[model samples]
Target chain A: MILVTLLIGVLVLVLVIMAMGPLESLGWWSDKGAEKAAATIERLREEHARSDLRTSYSRYVVYLSGIGAIDGESRPPEEEPFVAAIRDGVPSACLVTDVFPYSVSNHGLTAQRPMSWLWRRIEQARFKNPEAMLAMLVNLRNAIQLFVSADRRYGPTYNIGTAQQVLESLLRHGYRLGSGVPVTLVGWSGGAQISLGAAWYLGLTKIPLELISIGGMMSDDYGLDRLQHVYHLRGTKDPFEKLGWVMFAGRWPIAVGSPWSRAVKENRITIYDIGPMQHNVKDHYFDPTAIAPDGRSYLQVTSDAVVALLNGTEVQVIPT
Target chain B: MGDFLGSLWRAILGVWGLDSSMAEWFRDYPHSLEISITIAMLAGVSTLLGNSVVLFLNRIRGWRFALSLVFNGVSMVALFVVQAVVIALIGFLFTGDRLTFFQAARAVMLATAPLLFGFLELAPYLGPGIARVLQVWSLLALWTVVTVVYAVGYWEALLITGIGWAVMQGLSWALARPLSALGNTIWRALSGSPTLLTAQDLLSGHQFMPVEFDFDVSAVEGGERS
Candidate 1:
């Protein structure tokens, strides 16, 4: 009889829980302003969840992800090892964070589906998703490819949307350099092109802009002429940068009459050929002060370049 | 090919009133009437010749199937048409005259429509698998028409069609085998291929695996910085 009564009580509780949503049921135990308080709490959580935005001071540091960046809170501050290096290395007065162009989750250009157990498993397993690509193409509503606020090649333009977002976040929350902050971009591999595109989309030239492409591609150099300063840092061993040139050989039309040539002549674009750096940057991240296999720390050199640019100067480059 | 097989399994279950999810297999199909008709006619002819040759040509190693179209293309189509009509009439009587012969015939045709994809059966390894799939889809299509179009009870519609189909199948087994054998014997005596094509080689699929394909598509996708 006691067991039967207990079962009945459990069933009733379950029924009550089902009849009221979990939040609303919890709210009953709280005060009159529970809903409003929840709303405010949720709002603050959203602001906090913008993990991509980190404010320092007047100088803004926008970090873009390359081809193999980890998603969400799975890793440490070094989830983005290169960005983490910049965040730790840069002055406390500068804001530093990675951007999300085509985020698979809730933020940025998201493609949400109520997944089944199998679908969820597949989602966890990172594979080439042509379905998302097709979806983006089908839903595209852009007027010009150059200004289309997206990465036309694949998923959301992580670089394009992120650059604007960093600027907006600074304006909304940063104490200094909100609208007229000097911005420094540190991009690796494909991130360099994205950073380049972001500079164009956000019109970062209006402020003091220093763009860095660390062994990145040049699919279209539409934004090369506009940035205040440009840096192309090629690692001795990285093949990804060479892939773009290999695929587009007119031959190596990117060299002749390239916008960078003019920029280079005007002392606006600097190319650094680092001898010891590989495409991965695993060796480069270890010691900021120590010299690399190339005899000097490329990381220190790149950061110093940003520092010099912020100071209205240039980093000397070994001529290509 | 897996997609086609999955659709077939769904269709088989659908005919037995298990689930009506069979249409998903052909949901993307344009349902072009002209294409469907052309395919059905082409398949009817090919099936007729293939079955006839397989059954009759090699009397020493003779085998038989439930249905054949080679020598009896007209007969088989006519028999199925008759079977559908009988099912429609029986359904009308069973359901208090709610279903008409014409409506049921239209439904039957619609049900058989996906079988036109069997046309792809000539594409080496994948053909037989896809054709087998279409046959299952055809049955499911019949169930769809009976239930959704005629508004009949799922079980009753299944029963009426099942009985008619079984009867026709029995009749074909009894009559089709002997007739095809006689035709093959006569043809062999006249102009049939002297060397028999091995049944194993003809029916069994390729032993090779599907080609492996890989792409670094996520490289193009923007995610968190790795």
Candidate 2:
């Protein structure tokens, strides 16, 4: 009777916990503020499409995925406007590449469904436990292995392999990046990995490329000198970029590659810091800084960086 | 405030089979301090947990092993085949009026969406081990997709919460096998130690000491085969 009562009590507790989860979530629910961002992206796409260029481009375009948005490529065309935006460029074919969340890097191990679930449950109980967080991160090695081998259904379903396939096919189709003209590579977060990889691939074919890393992490051996232009955007208080959170006791990727390192290196790497934004790459463009030391708005600073890169001028910012 | 009350009334009426105005649904929803804070916390916690589970599964098994990939591919192709039969069954079992195919598909998706994440969590510990590099690459891809979909727009709150919980439970169950293996390994390590177990150890099921030799001497009862 005692055993039966204990088992029943445990079952009841489990049910109660499960039932409480929805109420907690509902009480705190807010629609993800992504639609507004999408509109902005659409505008950017249109602006890029309408930009004056000397050469007529083919219908071939490159699709770069952002952080936490790798699966964007596989999503049905009808459901995603981004694909249509790229398609408008009239590229004979498109390569929708998964870029960010740095899937191939150690950072990829830190981003997974199980850890997110546990984090939510813990936070709901108003408990902030570091041990729990570390335990969740321990499975990093396993996650990396799974990504490389499994097919879409049987595994994480990331199209990392298809990236190579796309590169191969582009060659077969006679698509080539000119050495003199700067090839543009836009990336956010892990998508930056794709940008770097794509740049390297293009370099293998002797193409000169320019890379724009919005809200990206850098490595010491990133070889930024290889690119015609490199833009490193960092948010001042973005949780992901903040020293405390970015390193998170030294487990996170940013802990290893301080953005300051790029400024020190004479690799044509320009680093811009936007204050108090949460890991948003586009935050670089928002003029939100208070009391600028240089007496310029954040937007002006960003525009200047772009203009400087375009005009091939040098700016005097010393390495820390 | 009046718009809010009107929407509430319309919602109540709509539940009772009335045509409710859009104002009732949109205007009436509470945007109060208490409600907003609660909603924000809920959304934050839900996302934290949901993403945690995704991260955990990806870490343990990797993204390439996520079950959602299979289900999405299958659904993409065979959604109609599932709808025809499942919808008919649900209609017969509930209201006696058959549900439309779209309705049925929606119902199924709502019910099974959580299971997809759960399967992703379980795939790693339960299946044959995959190459580590491939696993990470795939996970990066999966993580990117999920983020984009959710980041681009606000999805149903209920769906997010449900899916998050399902994944956590499914992953826990999947890793149980690996956990058991680990437990056995620990047990063997302890048993093989040369030192005798203490009284406190006995209380903790560590009283037994390992013999100097580590051989089994059980007699063979069965006759030897020719």
Candidate 3:
């Protein structure tokens, strides 16, 4: 009886958390003005102008990290090699890795939150004890925001906010808008949904937008039509990506009219099997030590796949 | 205040057919104020949360909109009373139970307990699905009340509630024009808005415009910080 009561309490709390993102986006809690967004962009442009990399990069790659992330700058040490490989592969491409995908305001979990201390401790604990229950709170919280991005009612508002932040990051990294320079969004896990969510708003700037989902769990509803193409990199052993297929009705076979289905039919979404990598932990996609049967590490193989996509090279494709 | 809250809690549980004793209290006492308050709360919460029916209330902006919500809630009680009369008539025809108007009204009002969580209708993606679930739950509650309180046959209760709902829907469709006009008038009177914004307009997030940025970067490359 106590267990049942606890389960009910947890369910109610989850619902409340899920409702909060949309309510915030809808300007129920507090309205975040457009002026702040404009100011941010302006500041980024000025900063970019002073940088040495200005006008040097040919293509722009914005990397949106998964739910485990607390802020824009901080990343798990295990994931760093995957990022390093991308930078090595595409030396000319400006890789912007500081856009936090979870918050509609682009504020980190520890940024001005009432539960900042808890989140900060959770972030620290994630490194020391990755298996701790408290560490999973970050994932749980962000996973809800991922649903918010998929939600039609809230997606536009949340996506616009994220897109603005992405735009600021792009500007900060010397991405000249309307230069017709292709902007590729590389998202890992839940960040894939955020990438897709922001695609519509980013597309508005007329920069050629592309998405590369690295074992991403995403719904089909978030304006797939706006992206030039979607390159999904999945591991043969990963079951988490399949969760997206089951959770969202729009991804189902019967939802033939959905953007994702249409994108598949139109041959816009390209799927690649990046060896036998798991979703996260124990031989995950970015695990350097997890060597594939083909004599390549999971990180190396995944990086090669992403590089191939960026370079528009032929790869082993999975037919829909 | 404690007594009121306790009764309200019992009323909520009773509507879900959980507490028979509470259902008996509602059937016996049939407090109009309590029923009205329940309906008012349902309407107020739904409006405040920006449910599709009263999504325009979101556009009002500021705490003064609380007055508009109160107006919407009180008006819903009047509407519920009218609906209860129709339900009572249908019940009499189907079950041959000559229940008093107040008894029938109280039963119908109490059955709306499921809708007290109408704020859940604002939840993204699941909102519409949740609304449908709540509607079905309320219908089942109505059937339960007729069976337990009115002592009507289960089949008769189903027929009465189902046909009563169908008739009400048909009436609503037939009187759509006048009903819409009346709704608009009431909305305007309360909100001071000429027209209520549709759910599409409200939920589309068009009110929050995307910030525009200068796309021209050639000046920056040429050492000019424009």
DockQ of each: 0.01, 0.01, 0.25
**Candidate 2: what lDDT?**
0.35
Off by over 4 Å in 1: A1-58, A72-89, A104-160, A172-179, A248-251, A254-267, A281-320, B1-226
Taking every candidate in turn, the Cα RMSD to the unseen true structure, in Å, is 24.8, 25.1, 6.3
Comparing candidate 1 with candidate 2, which one achieves the higher TM-score? 1
lDDT string for model 2 (A33-71, tens) is 122223333443453456443333333334444433323
Residue by residue across A1-320, what tens digits does model 3's lDDT show?
Answer: 89988997887677666666465555621344344545555654565456453366789999999988898877666778889889988888889998999877778888898788998998888779766688788888788788778887677667778888898788767777646788999999999999999887676556799999999988895458878899999988789987888878888999989989999999999888767777887888888887766677777788888988888786542222
TM-score of each: 0.37, 0.29, 0.84
TM-score of chain B of 1: 0.48
Pairs that collide in candidate 1 are: A57-A93, A69-B225, A69-B226, A101-A157, A101-A158, B48-B69, B48-B70
> Over 4 Å off in model 3, which ranges?
A28-30, A34-55, A316-320, B1-11, B17-26, B29-59, B185-194, B197-226
Relative to the real complex, the DockQ score for model 2 comes to 0.01
Can you write out model 1's per-residue Cα lDDT over A130-183, one digit (the tens) per residue? Answer: 233432321121101212222222212223344444545544546233245577
What are the clash counts of all predictions, listed in order? Answer: 7, 72, 0
**lDDT (10s digit) by residue, model 2, range B1-226:** 6764464444323322222232133223554223323322332233233323222222212342243233223322242233334434533443355545543333223222112222222232222122232223323322222222232222332233334434434544565456444434543564432332222222111112222222111111122211
Docking class of 1: incorrect
lDDT of 3 by residue, B1-226 (tens): 7877776766776666545566656666646447636664663465346353233313444553565455455445555676688778887786677878767777777777777666676666676677677778877887777776557667877888888777766665566566556656766675455544232222211111111232333332343222
- iRMSD in angstroms, per model: 29.4, 22.4, 7.0
Clashing pairs in 3: none
